[model samples]
Target: MVDRRLFDIARWSLMVAVWLLPVLYVFGLMRLLHLENAYHTCTQARFGVPDDRGLPVFGRLDSDVLPPRSVCTWVDGYTLDRVPWFVTPTMFVCLVVAAAASPVVISARRRGVMAGTARRPW
Candidate 1:
């Protein structure tokens, strides 16, 4: 048996979180759309991110050009191996929790066991 109060809290929390899916989806799309264009410059110049290690990178303009992007060009390459602070994980968690908890809550309420009472799923 579980505490009815705790169960209610979890059920409502999951419901609220699941309701944010649309907002999160919109926010994710907005973020992707607002990103600056990297393939071309605003002034009609071809720009590209280069892959350079200990060697010089080349641009599309001239193959003879030893380097394409300067040191300042390749900024913001900090990619840590961790979960992004985006809506992806949050939305996933919400969906999973809601899916798992909805059946339990509904069945409990229907069985006349959840009328302000605690009942464990059997």
Candidate 2:
């Protein structure tokens, strides 16, 4: 049997985490976008040439969400550059944790365990 105070503390912590997920995601996405922009700027400065429209004619940028890659690819399918190693993995872990926690929190709320006013059957 779990102590009531301990259980309430755990529930409150989980609630806080679930509430913060959106803010975390937004910040993570902003960081990812910033990194991607930096990658593009660097690639352009290194390999791009100004065409008629004055735009850098560097390689195209590509990205993947699951693995979280922002790659600059050349015309001939060569990889020019990519974002830092740490950002993507950190974001992935956060996303995974948020996904795992949502269901548990939702179930607890639905079962009235999170309300603190309901009695446990057990």
Candidate 3:
């Protein structure tokens, strides 16, 4: 059998990890968008008219002048291109579900003799 302290620690670790997942997802999405923005602006300045708004994705020219692959820390043309629009919405749903479920889970776990210990604020 698992030690009770180790079990509690593992449980707390999992809870914290699940709670942070949505935050990480949001940061990732923002970074991906920022990379796209950087590459877009870079390409616009490189080949297209300055301050142009009609440029295609990643500021690719309507003609053959495509933006070169970005080497910046956040820029990964291949990965950026594959990031789906559904990711943000999916994360939103997961975050909401986790938030809603936490209280219910805490209440459920508090039904034992340790109820007093679980009375602290979530």
Candidate 4:
């Protein structure tokens, strides 16, 4: 029993968000890559070149998409440094927003179709 106008607005907003999700993901990926590059550069400068064994003194650069992290890890599998807290949370929030909105939008569309009230053609 939702107001028609409000429901339409919400639906449109969710649709818009769905379209924007890729853009959000791309930006998040770019940010993570930038962070990883910076970390590698800094670590290389701080720790000098690789050892006689041809292994990096600063370990490896690693990243994750979900919950988004860019990290420098030590040889012993310990994190040396990570991107700021805000970076990961920003991507996480984007993921959560997409997760929360997609189901509602899909259900509303399905309901509309079931009721023979879908206006726009898919």
- Count clashing residue pairs per candidate: 0, 0, 0, 0
Q: In model 3, which regions exceed 4 Å deviation?
A: 1-83, 113-122
- Lowest summed lDDT across 10 adjacent residues in model 1 is found at 62-71
TM per candidate comes to: 0.47, 0.43, 0.35, 0.45
Per-residue error (Å), model 2, residue 17? 6.8
Candidate 4 has an lDDT of 0.58
lDDT of 1 by residue, 7-66 (tens): 687678767877786676665554333134322321122133332444333222211111
Show the colliding residue pairs in model 4. none
lDDT of 2 by residue, 1-122 (tens): 34445456555655665666555455445434643354455455455632224434455666565455656655455664345566556555656665665666666656566556566569
* lDDT for each residue of candidate 4 in 1-64, tens digit (9 for 90 to 100): 3445645665665666566666656665664664335545546544664232555445566778
- List the global CA lDDT of all models: 0.47, 0.54, 0.45, 0.58
Cα lDDT for residue 117, model 1? 51
Residue 87, model 1: lDDT of 58
Q: Which scores better on lDDT, 1 or 4?
A: 4
Q: What stretches of model 2 exceed 4 Å from their correct place?
A: 1-40, 43-68, 73-82, 120-122
Number of the top TM-score candidate: 1
Model 3, span 20-100: residue lDDT tens: 666656554443443335555445444464354654444231211112122222223422332334555656566665666
Task: Give all candidate RMSDs, comma-separated.
Answer: 11.2, 6.5, 11.1, 7.3
Candidate 2: minimum summed lDDT over ten consecutive residues — where?
Answer: 49-58
Error of 1 at 98 (Å): 1.0
Candidate 1's C-alpha runs over 4 A off are 1-3, 34-84, 113-122
